[model samples]
Target: MSFFSIFISTANAAGSPLKQFEIYSIAPMHFGNVNVSFTNSSFWMLLVVLVSTLVLSLGVRRSSLVPNRLQSISELLYEFIANMVRDNASQDGKPYFPFIFTLFIFILFSNVLGLIPYSFTVTSHIIVTFALAMVVFIGVTIIGLVKHRIKFFTLFVPKGIPLALAPLLIIIELISYLVRPITLSVRLFANMMAGHTLLKVFGGFVVALGFLGIGPLVVTVALYGLELIVACLQAYVFAVLTCLYLNDALHLHH
Candidate 1:
């Protein structure tokens, strides 16, 4: 049986840990046989976007000579991503700051917001993470192709290798490059899913044990804190990796 089905089967006996990840349609819609319903996932994603935009906009709306808390926060986030891009992708990366900033903010908010009770964690799903990764992968490839044309193929052929081993190394590199999306997506999805699953399991234990629920409750609290850190870290890691990839495309570095 599928993982979700396993959860569905046991849901009657005890709440399944995976139950939280289930997507529910808020407003079900069908275009012929295709379902395009507004789901909890969609709602959470929309909330994330709106929250991010409002926070950033409000943060700088009253910018002044003496920065207020909101303005300070806004500037900090701006500098954080700006420095990340410049440090990893170099000065040439300045032009792409907005794209990287938007990406980081979106993922960061999605992840952090998902930590809220009853909210859906979009990054916990492989499909969502994979789509984001593919966008980065495809965009990087396009930049490389446009900048270097025929030389873009050199990305798979490192700097120093014996002719005999060059072909083998190139093949290996090509395979690795092609799997970037899978690795990137799986990393985020697996971390978010595993963390939340553990939290749910422990939460269930707390309820089941009643008087002896203190231990599980404590553990659940700790996991929530850790998950919060992981959420931010994963967003930073994703942005950093994107900058690295962009650097490779722009500089043709091995």
Candidate 2:
């Protein structure tokens, strides 16, 4: 079965860990071989995009020498992402700031939005996260090949390696490089899925345990707080890693 379709069975069919990632056709449509239907996942994705755009647009509508609260928040995010790219990818990375910034914000917003009662988290799906990772992976690979040509191969062969060990190290490096998308996608998906599953399970306890559930409720509150922090952190880590990959591509550094 297809990776995206794997979530189909469990997502909408039942109330299980996988149910949160389910995508169903809101208005099912078919164009020959392709199914172009608007599903809940699509709804959430559009909502994420809309909300992100609105916040960013309104946040800096009135740019000023002395920033107000919204403008300050906007500037903070701008500078924060700028510094991340600068630190990891340097001046050359400045050109891709918008892409990186959009990605960071989108994921951050999605994660935070998911914490809302009865809301869906887009990043919890492997297909979604994998697509995002693949974009970065492919983009970096293209940049490296375009900039360095065949020399991009050197990325797999570190300097000062003994001649005999070069083959082994090169193989290891190649495998690691190729697995980036798998690891990146799985990390975000697993984290969101695990966090939400815990919340769901504990929520059931709260409803079932009644007054005694106060302790679990308190823990739930703390978990929510931690999840918020994690939402922001995972976004930062994803963007930072993107910059790092871009740095590798641009400079061909080992």
Candidate 3:
């Protein structure tokens, strides 16, 4: 193919909303019966991890008596998650503070990373989000089981309820409990995927319509601002929900 043809093909492929989500192997490999090949998704995840670690460490490396910009941000995020835990999950949730804080930072970084041009959004994939949610779900379940033993089952049964309606409520509660991962995963994945897709669509219009695309380009710029907010908000929402779930398992309020 000619150079111009190649460039056109590349540009068109890059503009597709779904194209950004594609998982292509970077260094294809196999582990016996499993395909554990490194992929764009995997690469992005590693990048996120590295960046998170670097920022947190370097941010406070100086440990100044008076905080720098980096130190201030690190402390702000730390206190934010700590206060959130205190308010939502109470002192009982203190032991799990590190887990919750790390969870928030990871998702928050993943969302922000996806905003980079041509970067993959790991949370946009159901499997990634589902895996994270499962950790929270299973962790809480184990905590409940270990703490309350068989009595944890009583969480599904409310006090002073009519015997006739007990079975119905139990079934409803059981299903809801089991479906936490699904809802949690879908909420993050759907929002990130949909918002990114909309941005991609507008971007394509800008390239295709040229001068006539000025309006769409402006909307796309506005969307970038909104998506940045959403990226942070979704991370906060997921973290808060996890706290609520943790509280439920720990205290059985609902």
Candidate 4:
């Protein structure tokens, strides 16, 4: 084989491995006329839920006064979310604690799990992130309406504004409010997807370079560590934003 031919074959093989990242439909079984199809993303979501449930359950199963290692860790996580809610959403945030806690746990687990080799990152996809963002958007909207009634429109109209500027302010507020879901979902999906794709591309370089791969390998490891921090940070940011939105719903601070 010529050198050029060998190079082409190696390049083809290298590219072929990336095909594992491709999303595909999984057919579990047919339920009569309906076909039950699951995507790789959905599978990861389910795994996240199951793993999170098991971890928390085991952590809290044996409640002791002094506390064991697992229980203490669980308690710390609880306190972290509690403090975040209290600080961001105020005292009334107590009512939305469950929703906020669940959001944090789900996102945190999904992100951390995705860091593992061969694992799928569901949050890397816009559909999953958008679905989550839409849920928050709808819930906040409903809460605002329920709490303020017709006064919910006040959210788009700033108080203390002059009558002359009210229309302009309202238009700006309306546009900002409408853009929340897009911003929230895209921020998460873009970050996760970009980080993972970069990591994968660098990792591929590390493998393809053979004996000269050490440079890319070291960079890949550094990036992996950075990605882990990003995973947690993104989850925290998402949860904090949700709390802020909930606060707006309950307090209408516009």
- lDDT, model 4, position 233: 95
List of clashing residue pairs for candidate 4:
none
Per-residue lDDT of candidate 2, residues 46-124 (tens digit) = 9999998888778888778998888788789999999999999999999999999998998998898998978999998
lDDT for model 2, on a 0 to 1 scale? Answer: 0.86
Q: Compared with the true structure, what per-residue lDDT tens digits does model 4 show for residues 1-254?
A: 99657544654556654454577887565679886668787688899999988888888898889889888878888999999999988998898899989998998998899889888887887888898999999999999999899999899988899999999999999999989999999998888888887777777776777887788789999999999999999999999999999899989994
User: Among these predicted structures, which one has the highest lDDT?
Assistant: 3
**On residues 99-214, what C-alpha lDDT tens digit does candidate 1 reach at each position?**
99998998899899989887889889999999999999999999999999999999999998899999899999999999988998999999999998888877777776678779
Q: What are the per-residue Cα lDDT tens digits for candidate 3 across 1-254?
A: 99657535544755666888999999999999899999999999999999999999988998998999989889999999999999999999999999999999999999999999899999999999999999999999999999899989988988788999999999998999999999999999999999999888778767766687697789899999999999999999999999999998899876
Candidate 1: residue 104 lDDT (0-100): 92
Clashing residue pairs, candidate 2? none
Which runs of model 1 end up more than 4 angstroms from their true locations? 1-14, 30-34
Worst 10-residue stretch by lDDT in candidate 2?
6-15
Candidate closer to the true structure by TM-score (higher is better), 2 or 3: 3
How much is 102 displaced in model 1, in angstroms?
Answer: 1.1
Ranked by lDDT from best down, the candidates are: 3, 1, 4, 2
Please, what is the TM-score per model? 0.93, 0.92, 0.93, 0.90
Error of 2 at 71 (Å): 1.1
Q: lDDT for each of the candidates? A: 0.89, 0.86, 0.91, 0.86
Error of 3 at 2 (Å): 33
